[model samples]
Target: MINTFTKPKRLYQEIGLRLYEELSDSRFSVGDRLPPERDIAERLGVSRAVVREALIMLELMGLVEVRKGSGIYLIKQPTDNSLNNELESTLDNDDVGPFEMMQARQLLESHVAEFAATQATKKDIIKMREALELEKQNIEVLDHNHDADKLFHLAIAEATQNSVLVDLVENLWERRESSPMWKQLHCHITDQTYRKKWLIDHEEILLAIQQKKPDAARMAMWRHLENVKDTLLILSEHKDPSFDGYLFSSNPVQI
Candidate 1:
């Protein structure tokens, strides 16, 4: 017997489809709230990031609504297959704004930085130093090394010693890599000065974490993302009118 059933291509997609089925089957009617992200993640043996991403996808499909500080609720009995079809064919870069992605990162990584600072071991700090050194070296080359930058962030997440937080950081990085919109937006923004500024921000974050200052770590992470959002907004505006649709603010995003 030849078994040909393959797993879903993406973990979040698999989780999203299963969540759709569960929502359809459950007694919870339209307007009823779904389980919390942590609850859902625990029930399914997945990371909170996986659940969060699935929820975002479902919201885009018009199957559910997310009321921040309240909860996620089922808004419609059925989702639009047209949206799904469009997603299958190609994702519209406009569908996800750079501001939106940065907002999500701000929410997750601020807390992650806090936790990593509080819980980081001596070895963890060493690993982070190594990543930082690599980032510095990579930035000098003609071709930028995104992997080194990624490693630095991942090292901070690793310091947390919480599997879920680690997963969330990794998930965010993966999404950034895979997002066409992110690539398009960055193409217009990235330059030597921008890279140098980011490296300095990374160093500030690293210093706070190494010193075991949770508050400082959180603020450092928040400020770094805020700067990133600001720069992206400026570049996005210059590149396309579609980016003007994204809400912009000089004030920092509140998580």
Candidate 2:
């Protein structure tokens, strides 16, 4: 008998949902081998590509393990890490603004700093201090080293003692590499004085966290983001026409 299921409008999502449902059945226990791609495509009346896409989604959700030569197997039940999921979503959107990115960083990193203050081990604190020192040196050279900046942030995230938050912060930094605002800000602000000021602000943030003061850390992050916002606004006003609605909108936090 022919299966009567029609192909889904969004093939990837439809395939993902179908795979998710199939995997959810108790019969598909952990480590159970999944049917081959061809078999799945035939059974679902969809192309092999759709099945593959679905499988990728399943892998991302932590539902299945894909072994190159051994085929796919059920791994474990899926668990959502909200911060990682949000970072992934933000990375996928091309129009994400600086404000939105800052807002996300503000929400996630402020809490991360607070946690890091309480949870940081000696090694974590040492790494953070090292990163801060590197940032300080870079400021003297007036170099806009995105890598160093990201490393500093990642060190703070690591101090939180949360792997999930570390991953989220890393992902956000990756997204920033392609961000229009990031590119523009680097081009517009190239002075050593500005770099020194930014480094000093970061130092204050680190000091607050080192003191294990949650409130101080949160306020420091807020002030730093506010400074970033002001800098971006000044640049946007001078060069860019702001004709693109995406550039001027203030939904920095909601994205």
Candidate that scores best on lDDT: 1
lDDT of 2: 0.63
Q: How would you encode candidate 1's per-residue C-alpha lDDT over 127-213 as one tens digit per residue?
A: 888887887787777457678788888889989998888898898888888875466556545455677788899999999998999
Per-candidate total of colliding backbone pairs: 0, 2
The deviation in Å at residue 83 for candidate 2 is 36
What residue runs in model 1 are displaced by over 4 Å at the alpha carbon? 1-96, 239-247, 250-255
Residue clash pairs of candidate 2: 99-252, 100-252
- For all predicted structures, in order, the TM-scores are 0.59, 0.55
Best candidate according to TM-score = 1
Q: Rate the local accuracy (lDDT) of all candidates.
A: 0.70, 0.63
